[model samples]
Target: MIAGLTWLVGFQLLGELVVRVLDLPVPGPVVGMLLLFAYLRLRRYDDSGSIVIAGSGLLRHLQLFFIPAGVGVVAFASVLGRDVLPVTVAVLGSWFLGLVVVGWTAVGLERLLGRPRDDLGDPPAEAAA
Candidate 1:
């Protein structure tokens, strides 16, 4: 367990170092995650599955990671309240736009693939008795 934890933090540190050294626009954790993914992919099932086991153990505690963010939100409750309208608008607008884009894309793909509109429906019900 300790060794697995080390592996996770070690990669994150390595990522942080790279980001700082290169002045990367991307986040260090993102880089670290990418590195870990590649490493796992390259050596899947290596180390008698210790790495996978360790990773899964850590994932089980993932919800704890949100505690700090929740605290920060609580700390800045006033600021959030002040900007609630704009924040709400931005969030709602993005959601609406995303759904519209997805719907359009699905329709476009279906048309491109030549699926008939009726195929999108449930099976026809038996005629009313």
Candidate 2:
């Protein structure tokens, strides 16, 4: 577990270093995750690998990671309240846009792949009834 955690942190640090040096616009953690994914793909580690075990352990307690974000929101409550209208509009607008884009993409992919929508298995018994 320690080794796995170390590897994870090491990759993150390496990512940070690369980003800083290259003046990247992306977050360091995102780059680190991509690097880790590439490494895993090339190395082909099994489920029992230390990295996988550590990652699973972290995922099991994923909710704990949200604490900081919650605290930040509370700290910025006043600011958020002042900009609530814009924030709400931005959030809802983005959500609607994403939904439309994803729906269109799914339909496009389905057509491109020659997969008919009706071929999706039978509906639930309750729905059929």
Candidate 3:
């Protein structure tokens, strides 16, 4: 478990260092996750399953991570209330944009993979016949 924790933190720290040194726009943790993924893909885990154990342990307490955010919202309730409209617009606009991008990506992937297009609402030709 300790080893796995070390591996995770080590990657994150390395990622942070890389980002700072390169002055990249990407978040450190995201880079760290990619590094971890690459490492896991290239190497097999030990029989002790330290990585899985550590990961599950961390996940078990994931809610703790959000406590600060919740507290902040309560702390700044008045400020947030004043900016509610703009915040709502930003959130909804981003969500709609994400949906559009995802739809386009799915269409592109389907064409690239030579898969049949989805026709969820339309009746099949055999059924129509």
Please tell me which predicted candidate would have the highest TM-score against the true structure.
2
| TM-scores, each model vs. reference | 0.68, 0.79, 0.70
For model 3, the run of ten residues with the poorest summed lDDT: 43-52
| Model 2: lDDT of residue 12 | 95
Deviation (Å) of 116 in candidate 1: 16
How much is 35 displaced in model 3, in angstroms? 1.1
Q: Which of 1 and 3 is ahead in lDDT?
A: 3
In model 1, pairs of residues that clash are none
Candidate 2 versus truth, CA RMSD in Å, comes to: 3.0
lDDT by residue for model 1 (10-122), tens: 99999999899999999998999998899988877575666677888888999999998989977887877678999989999999999999988998899999983755365
RMSD versus native structure for model 1: 5.6
1 or 2, greater by lDDT: 2
lDDT scores in order = 0.86, 0.91, 0.87
Error of 1 at 47 (Å): 8.9
